[model samples]
Target: MSDAQELAALLAQLPDAELAGVVGAATEGRAGLAALHAVARSLADTLGHAPDVIDVTPDTLPVAGYSQSETVGGSGQVGAGPVAPGIPVPPAGIPTAPSIGGYSSAGVPTFESVRDKVEQRYGTSQGMGELDRQTPVGRSVEEQWEARAEAARERLDQIRKSMQGNDSE
Candidate 1:
């Protein structure tokens, strides 16, 4: 007998009070399990009357002329009809994106090619040669720092003159 049937037989021999006591004791630490057991018992009682045999065949087969694939195993021989069951072919007239990666209708766009396309469609960035032609020669870092220091000194002189006038007042 199955473990469930054996358990049921053992439980049946217990007195009503003893069974109640056993259930009460189990409920303390195994409340979730007890609740699950109760639900399973209720479902078993409801569904025990009859078990139905279900039909599990497909409603319709693929049309006779429909061949799943043009080539089978690279043998160049076309399949006569629908091969082993698979996803149905999408209806025609639905627009689909082009395949990506190696050996497809459209070649995969490379970074350089994509960049060139974008530059051509949009405009190219300022080339170093063009920048050199347009801009004056750049000062060295030390010369740039000296220019900033001179500007700061002139600003400080102006501030000092303004403060002197305020102090006199």
Candidate 2:
């Protein structure tokens, strides 16, 4: 028998749970292989030649640290200072601004101020005014519940009459 036929025969002997586990593992393996293949194809397309072998080691791997490329002073060299850990280095060409709880010296509106301005300009929040108008004015929760209950009772009476007529026929 061929390898596929032999594998299928072996799989048939396995319990339902074991077979499902094998199938799941095989699916995950296939997906991982497919992803690796796609990455290789993308690299080949981008670069003139694709690498035959990628030798990844601890030394070759990127370490997380603040990049010294951003010079503190007008001097073209980076200053020797201890950077706070876990702080990320911003990418090149992007303007960096200091912010305090969304408030900035760059004339950017803070979160609270923005919300207030929007409320003032639009006359309450987007749909709050419409919601208020739609709501029954001066009606208590108990009154609304009683009104809904009366409507339900009327509907139930109609259904009962229809059912009684059907039974008589």
Candidate that would win on lDDT: 2
Q: Write the per-residue lDDT of candidate 1 for residues 91-151, one digit (tens) a residue.
A: 3432334443322334456566677678876554446545555555533554677899999
TM-score of 1: 0.20
Colliding pairs, model 1:
none
Candidate 1: C-alpha lDDT = 0.53
Each model's TM-score? 0.20, 0.20
How many pairs of residues in model 1 come into backbone collision? 0
Stretches off by above 4 angstroms in model 2 are 1-98, 101-137, 140-145
Q: Tell me the spans in candidate 1 whose CA falls farther than 4 Å from its real position.
A: 31-169
Pairs that collide in candidate 2 are none
lDDT of 2 by residue, 1-169 (tens): 6645765777799655444444443344356566655554454545444444332222322356844444244443466443323334433433346664355655466888788778787886646766755667624555788899999999999999999999999
Q: For residue 43, what is the lDDT in candidate 2? A: 48
